[model samples]
Target chain A: MYSFTKPKKKQFFKEDTKLWLVFYAISVFLYVSFALFLLVKAYFYSKNNQIYNQNIITLNTKISSLTLQKENIKLQKTIYEDIMVKNSLIKDSIKNLLDLIPDPITLNKFLLKKDSLIIYGITPTKDVYNLLMLPPLESIFTKTDTTFYQMPNGWYKFKSINKLKGNNETAFN
Target chain B: MKLPSIKIKLPKLKIYGIDVIKNALFFAFYISMTLFIIAFIIAPSVKIFKNAKNSYFLSKQEFDNTKQNYRHILEQLTKLQNQNQQILNAFKRNFNENNFKLFAKDYMNIIKITKQKTIPYKNQFAKTSYIITAQIKSPKNFYDFINNIKNYKNIIRVYFPIDFEKSNKEINLTFKIETYRLLTAKAEEKAH
Candidate 1:
């Protein structure tokens, strides 16, 4: 019955509380800084969006004004072309009238009015009158009146009054 | 080296229930604070960052579109200016007064060449209208005269009538032609 008792060892909990606390503080700080950075980025993006919206508005206004000007120019060009076309028609009509005159006959006095023509001319013979009253000339006039006088100089003097027909309805407004 | 020393031992300290609860409550508060940061602050901040990135891209795209539209409009304006210049040039070429006079001289020469006698007549001029009057001999010569006048590029209107004299083969033809001429800058301003 000889029993020997051993000395008791000290009991202690092994924990690095200071290191843990420091780590947690650093983590929270990092989260907060990252959140603040995100907020700043959001603000910057919103500002950029506002600037871009303003630019778009300015551009739209400019585009609209320019479009209006372009349309105005195009309208002016159309009017010019219409005037040229009408002038060309009138010139062609005058040319056709000139071509309708018979050869070998001399013209003394020719008068053109608003919608009619008056001609006083001498022909060597009366047969030239038939030529003047022919198809092309007939088609151009709605009415024609002719009077012939025998001259002492062995020539026939004739006076012709002609009224021009209206142009086709579809040709112009 | 001598006899064994006897040591007196102290009693172990007991942890009370309230102290344990206090420690547990502290740990829970720390954990809850971390959770609160993660759930409220950090999570929402991440969402804000994502939204900001998306907005930045959208804004950039819109800016690019606006820039392109602006460039296109500028190009169109340049094209319009060129067209305006062309219209002005064409107007100058077709409506010059000196050119109209030259055309009239050429027309008179053509009448003479066609064996027609031309009566001297005065020309009437206005802001936008010109009239030249002449007399010729034969109907054929008048026809030729009209045809030759048609070759002139600037004539706008022509009116001619021939009357034949009973005494001879000669005819008196009166030609009234209309044309345009470019106005002076001052005149143009006045007209407008």
Candidate 2:
């Protein structure tokens, strides 16, 4: 492009040649300055691209890990919930058994030993004691074993064995 | 007559390949400068803007895929939750039955055996799987109790303890037990 600006200058002292020389100097300076700017910009742009790619890779990794964590948590919840249900069943079983204890069998002292019960108490009369000693009642009490202690004060210290399913009145006998 | 003895002084300049090379280098420097200014500074900025638009489109596509995956996971989680609810309801119904009292009685008998042997039941589990442990103070009593337990119709096991100490009247024995009923029930249900 500069070839179009060539001049017919046989004499360096001529006014026209001097004018062209001045223009050439200015153009050289402008070109050199522009080249330097490009070099600096290109270096920085390449660096920016490298960093951008790295960030995308890091984000992709994090997303995958989070997905795995979510799946593990869901599985854990199911297992934990099943355990809670079994525990509730055990609790309800205890409540139902407590409700079955009969009235009038005033329980004075009760001890739970192994699968049996030992009681120390007074029944109003011996007939009531005899009635309670029957097999249906005794079977309930002796499902494990029941023993009673007779005190001199007419108050008896009684011990009896009870299966959790037995009649509650057997405790009085 | 006036031109006699006149000598014109000329500018003296040296000729070397170095000067030609310098001139060629300067010219090339100028041309490359113009091309690079347009290519690096101006052209790339345009490309950068275009790439920004491309990035936005790519991110949008990725976001859509992630959202779809999230929706699928949510659906699976909801189904699991519903199944869990049904299982819990069934368990509750079973627990509230009249026979629960009998089950407690049986369970208490086992506890009594444990206490008679002076073994404490551990309430905590070791791993994600189920674990059971038993300790007996008297080996003779434990032997007898084990015989009785074997006669009973419940499924159970007694593992030998790794460490046991025997002092005087009691011989301590430790064992482990596990159940497949609660542990693998869900997987079996799914299989069916």
Candidate 3:
């Protein structure tokens, strides 16, 4: 009797197994190194952030102090200027009154109190006394009262009280 | 004649111990080279770069803050200067001695217009006030003089005392006039 036999095929192992192992080892090494590097970088970043925060705080304080100083300076300057302006106005008012006095009048006593003016002097004639009641003088005072007496020496003694008006009243008030 | 074919058999190959050790040593060398590059070169370089970046940002922020502060100070300075200028202008528009003298001269002119003769006797200046005494020919001339001076500017108040002497056909009048000026530095010093 003849017997039939089947043919057997040869088996082969995968190629480059050693090379793959080396590649895996190198990859693991690189990964660990990168992770450590990241950790170190994070630490440095945190330290730097803290330093910067401190610097900013210091700068802010300095700026606030400077602002306060500026405000103080402004206030002082304003006060000084106000005083000077008021003084000037008062001086001008005085000059205005002095300009209005007419010649040929002799003043014996002159007194200024608040918004009132008092004058005591001698007038040669009644006409000179009448002239005191007109125009520029009239405009300067709100009210005026005059008292005159004829002396034995033929001279007239006069006293006048005038109330200051307008600018003078407002300025003193 | 047909000859019988003979089958040939090959010898089996075997792995040696030295070859295994050699492969292991090669793998170790490769790992060491990778470690050296990562620890000594790449890692340190990365750390240095990170440090440089952090410092750059910090300095940049500081610069910006300083610039802002500088601008704020400059603005304050400008405001102060403007206020000072305004004060100066106000001072210029106000009181001066020259103006006072001019006002007095104008008053004398008004007296001349009234056809009166006045002889100025004494002029006394005080810190805050001025007093002028004059002798007039007649009471009428004195009254006209008073009327003219009433509207003078800058007179906070005025004081005049009238005294008269009788001469034949003529009345002689003497008057004292007081006026004020703005307070000055010299006046303040004297007060102190």
Assess the local accuracy of residue A9 in candidate 1 as a C-alpha lDDT between 0 and 100: 68
**Model 2, runs deviating above 4 Å:** A1-25, A28-32, A39-43, A70-74, A97-173, B1-192
Top DockQ: which candidate number?
1
Q: In what order do the candidates fall by TM-score, top score first? A: 1, 3, 2
What DockQ does every candidate get?
A: 0.29, 0.03, 0.07
Please identify model 1 stretches exceeding 4 Å from their true place: A1-21, A104-127, A130-134, A144-173, B1-35, B42-56, B80-84, B89-192
lDDT of 2 by residue, A46-89 (tens): 55655556655665565676566455445444544544443333
Q: Which candidate is the best by TM-score?
A: 1
lDDT of 3 by residue, B73-182 (tens): 86776677675654323222333445544554533322211112222212212223333433345444544444444334433223323334444554443333333332
TM-score of chain B of each: 0.37, 0.31, 0.35
What's the best-to-worst order under DockQ?
1, 3, 2
TM-score of 3: 0.41
The residue-level lDDT of candidate 3 at A134 comes to 36
